[model samples]
Target: MLRYPAVEISKGPRTVPWGTPEVTLDVSDVESCTTTFWVRSAKKQFIHRLKRREREESEDSNEDDYVPYIPIKQRKKLKVRQAEKRLGRIGLLKEQEAGSTSEGTSEGGNEGEEDEGVNLGPKSKFSLLDQHSDLKRKAEARKETAREKILKEEEKILESVAEKKALMAVSELAKGIEYTDPIKTGWRAPGYILKKSEHEHEKVRKKYHILVEGEDKPAPLTAFREMKFPKPILHGLKKKGIQHPTPIQIQGIPAVLSGRDMIGIAFTGSGKTLVFTLPIIMFCLEQEKRLPFINNEGPYGLIICPSRELAKQTNEIIAEFCGYLEKDGFPPLRSALCIGGLPLNPQLEIIKRGVHIIVATPGRLMLMLEKKMFVLDICRYLVLDEADRMIDMGFEEDVRTIFSYFKGQRQTLLFSATMPKKIQNFARSALVKPVTVNVGRAGAASLDVIQEVEYVKQEAKIVYILECLQKTAPPVLVFAEKKQDVDAIHEYLLLKGVEAVAIHGGKDQEERTQSIDQFRKGDKDVLVATDVASKGLDFPDIKHVINYDMPEDIENYVHRIGRTGRCGKTGTATTFVNNGNDETVLLDLKHLLIEAKQKVPPFLAAKELENEKYLNIGGEAGCSYCGGLGHRIAECPKLEALQSKQVAGIGRRDYLANSSADY
Candidate 1:
């Protein structure tokens, strides 16, 4: 601190006196100096002053015009305001220009002035407010015109719809009138007989709950003898221990014998087969006795069954009666079984040898007819046994085709356990002045059969079936919904050391025939089958029917249980149900049980409260469409399914045709 000067420090660049030379210092001199801090501060000040001078000089040389800083947001707002003001000025100018042009055109009434206005310079390309207003008005006018046109089209469509509805109503009324015309037609019993028994007929019908519908319906018979069967036929009936005519036979026989087309609906195992069979034989016998049939000359009666088994059974019955006729010194009435899975040569030979009656299934009969194997020219009696089943199996088209082959007016008899409204409608179209014989409600379970419904899980169904079998003795019928299920049940029963035989559509014809024959002869204890056996196949001694799984359709369920409780014999039917079953079918089953006065399970009874609306819909008059107790004709699933199938088939055919044309 010998002779050091005080250092002056500032926040900005250090100032030096003007015209003063820059000072330079050596590192060695500074290090030797005792007051090194003063020396370093002086040196930093001199270097800082030189740097500041250089920066000023560079900025002076590179500097551009000065602009005041403004925030981006404020700049943007200012620009938007300026643009709005410019648009306002432009709009004002356009309006003023339009007004001036209009004034000029109005003030100058000369044609030259108007021509000049129309021929304006190309510079006047801008649109005026008046022009814009004119465009908007024209657009609105177009929209209004379009709306009026659309409304008119809608009115036309509505009028067409009304006209179609009127036509439909007129057609329905005409159909009603035609069906109800009371003029008696077709073959009928003698006036004296019908008149004498009219009062007794009413009493008999009332006593048996027989519902007869038609114009001049024939009187129902109270005894088999009233039919006046041949002595041989009477003996055959007595041998079979048939004491009196069943309810179906009481009305059905009389109607058919009177030569009237008939729709006979009765409970299963109620002697429906006999109802048609006896009438067909009587017709055939009368034809033979009148004029004997020569080679390929006659098939006076034709019985069309849905299943081969049913056809075979019918053929056997006819043969048995024919044998009786032959033994009674009448000409032998030969009947041919024209079903599939048999020797065609034999059937053809029988046809060539002149047969009086023919029992066949739809498929084989259609084939025979298509091949010109036999003619139906002389076939006057047509019987459709299990008519509902035939329609359900897709034989409707075949039946219609067969109808085309008829050369004369045939007495068509349609017999079934259940008659749905759809079938009734079909009958109206197929038969003329047909008499309807109905015993009990259509699709109702037999009062003689005890129905048992149990909740069994899928895993426990097989085990539960064994327990179900134990409830009844041998010669039981176990019906399942699927062929695989039939096989499974058959396998399970055999493994459990039970004697069972199975038959399904998947089996060979020979195997199925053998199984049925064995079961019929009591060689097998249990018969596991699908719906193939549910139709009009009669097993006289079947004491129990076990439904391994309920059918989807309530009508099928009725038929399945009908296998038992036939011919006035009491039987038991046990159905296994679980949560997996369809609620609709379960509801139908519940209502059927309630109607039959059978005990319902807790789960089923619980659903009754929730479906109260459906419960009373078909109270006394069950579903007229499908005869289901849980639904009305409008909600019939079977009818809907058939309709949908037909529609889909039509659509498919149309699509295929279009595709072919495109190719």
Candidate 2:
């Protein structure tokens, strides 16, 4: 597309050579030869016009262009015209003599144009067809009307029957639902409550003994019927087979319903799920009243958990309750579960279709946020279930970063079994004047869990589990520390002729979900797993919890054993604490056992006494001489010189005193 510049060469007047004069040039002829001068931009258009003209000429060169296609009906009409003309000469036909009414004409477009045998004498084709065709059409119309009427009546009868059945079911459910509203209650009003606030709080306190032990604990809501929850929520509770509210649910539901941030400190499986879920459903239904029903393109509520299993469990609970919502006048609730080891495209599609609630693990949710898959500005309810575990898993920063995405005033609820210093900081910064509900002792195991530890060697742990399995019933949960151990345990169980499945982080989401399903349905009587399945997974009817490999952290131990002994079901938790296998966590393990009111086995007490006598290197990092952290006593130059001086003056006795100052 290179273009050259136009060259205008000016030359002095000079006569051409001898042959130049022979060329004859007429100015008029030169001017007439030029048709039109096209601009640079219009040159292509000019050429196209020429091509179009040639194309038109080629198309018009057909020989049959003048002969129009006369249909068969028209051919018959022409013959009729000729006959009519002949007949008119004899005066048999009058008006049609001119052949004005030809085929395909306004005058000829009628049922009569359709040929019926022949037109004899002066009669047209319709004279034969009219009597039969009209009769057929009227009869068919009558039959169609009758069929439509019958179908409408049948549909009405079926619909009426279905309506009656639904009504009967609702009436039956209503009969069992318990509801009471003795007095008007308020968010700030405690004295006017139906039950004595302090007495009920103390009862919930003595039972759950929740965290934030020293701080204020919200008034506990004990009964489902007395709280007078919305009728729909009550039905949902009944559907879940929950007749009464847990201590956490008691304080939590009312606070959340009154529109305030709350941090519920209760153990796992204490029905903390319903506390947040009921409010979220109520909020969505309320929003539906004010806003037009639409695919909730963005979430109105968000629930974040530490692990994939917990997030999935919360998602199921949310979906279950949402299913119980009224079908009329509002959009159906939609929720999406996003976690690691799953397809991203499908999750994005769920968000695209719209979601009213999103239950997701921190890592997966953050990944989606990074990809801008969905907007979080619309989420008004933020629930951080198992907040302590989330921080332990290193999701603290991700949690804070996610909180930044909320553009509106959000209601943040942080539910944790124990609130540590880090969790306290997180709640302080994220929550808005939050009401704290402490059900049980902070950093303590549930009272319902019957805990016992074995002094079995590491290699004999599986043997101990086998014996326990033979004694215990089906539907037992066995926890191992690592994935390979979980797999080995599961394989061993299978080889031993026991039905079992293993779930861990190494397995994909589908495998994990399938394994969980098998265990849930009792298809697999035994479920071997790692800590991945420990938090927030509700497996009711879990008869026994066996720690084949004791958890390294005491918090995990609480969560692991919390699986069983849930919902007032007495269950046993047998932990295998080998003398040498788990020495590092022995001290914390003992303290946890003592605080939980479980008998610290003789071996555990011996370990503590032995640790007191022996050189403990894994003790809290601090100054060796002063027991302060951040520096070593041997590395201290002042202490080094002092020790050298003391060695000369006070001998080795002073050295022991210097090192054992805190001891």
Candidate 3:
């Protein structure tokens, strides 16, 4: 029901002679009242007559009452508003005064020669023109400066709002975390202060005899057999020079070899693969002698990695360790690699045929499942390498989907460097009363790696990182928070004659593998990487891990540094800290450094450590002598005195004044 506004009409009927002399009538009806008009030219005549009466009455009134004049306040306000609108329209409000001075010449000149004495000579004209030009440039510069200042202020406000929102969300998450159950620790190291007793070392040596002694006497194939490996493998190990089982393998192997589902909580590069793989290979060998063929029964051992590069590297490791079993009278082991960015049909073909071990990323395996190519139901042993990373990559849904395909009872081994509450919860639900093997702190910082963090300004990050790199030698693995940043840093380093390669999720499997190989083969001096290479990468020669960009989540910081200092080899990790305002990273860094027995440099402990201080300069703080910020003389209250001193000492102003007078 749409409604219309009511309209009023007036009707008038003309009195006319009967019949033949009939006249046409114009209708006019107003407020249901009738009006009659008898004269011709009624409209004009009525209007004129009415106006005449009104005009006569108005003209008879006092002249002073009808005077036209505006109040001073009103007139001034109108003029100010007009000026403001003009400035606003031109977008020159911030530099209006300067702009007016720039255009010094007037639109029209006087014809009379009364002002001829004020005219300039040739040199003065040139000087005046230069002055006008300088003024114009200054005005333009001021406008740009004002606009940039406004934009920066707006950005600061927006960042503040976003930070508040993030804080609220984190607070809610923390509240939820409070209600969750903590993971129970099963195995414990002997003492409050961890020490290797002579007898304990002996027991460890015997138990891990494969590392120290070349003989394999049912003792778990230790992380590194001290018994020198074959010259080639030994040479590689000797180059790395790691000939011992790390804490993780020492504790984790026994649980894994005995067919127990275990959750290992240790630092990255602590030989976690051998913890599961050594036992799985041993188990596989034992199974292969009895059952020669596992047609449609595999992939008997499935290792799911978060990224393709990791999957490929893990596959290579499997091949390397399986090579060791060949000399031990084991059948030739067949393994297949399946990941994205590769031919799916070939991967399906490889899986369709028999495969003892299948290493794959979550996405490709899910696609393979849709085609009915292979099933995880036949998988007897499952390993989620770098489980934290898998979860971090938003592959939880995909991982859960893959688990649905496995119906039979299977052993699940979950490994992660730093297990947050989320990963622990996933492990608790995913594993069947799993035996938890925590070699170091269950959920604490690694004791092996020497973690170092330096606070720097946002703009100073590149220079700081460059300076830090220049201080150190080669074999530094730099971790960036973004792929584009990795590419950028990689390019910049290359331009500066520092050999480097970039690796990220965007790279193809081959490119990623090649980049890792280059980093490993000493072909590239620096490797700039995103989080893709942060997990499960066993690069032993990594002397320094530089967090070129801080991780968004603090836990990623732990994993990025985990790349170096593995297997009793000491390594240093340095994180660039521009995110000092970030409560999580700042607090975590403080807590970690303090707990690790490292001196928290007073500079790092401060909330906002200025980059200028690191460069040996006073930053934004006002000077004690002049009470001036940003500049000593320009913004100082005693600028006149400073100018006098400068003029007397350097005579720059006197020279300028003399030039002005001469001109």
Candidate of highest TM-score: 1
lDDT preference between candidates 1 and 3, better one? 1
CA error at residue 23 for candidate 1, angstroms:
99
Question: Which of 2 and 3 is the better model by TM-score?
Answer: 2
Q: Which stretches of candidate 1 lie over 4 Å from their true place?
A: 1-197, 609-611, 614-622, 633-635, 640-663
For model 1, how does the per-residue alpha-carbon lDDT over 91-208 read when each residue is reduced to its tens digit? 5543554556343321112323321123233224446886678668889887667655644553453343221211112333445523333223234554656777667778879998
Q: What's the lDDT for all of these models?
A: 0.74, 0.64, 0.59
Off by over 4 Å in 2: 1-220, 225-228, 293-296, 327-331, 582-584, 609-663
Top-down TM-score ranking: 1, 2, 3
RMSD of each: 19.6, 34.4, 29.6
Output the TM-score of candidate 1. Answer: 0.69
Descending-lDDT candidate ranking: 1, 2, 3
Structural similarity to truth (TM-score) of each candidate? 0.69, 0.61, 0.56
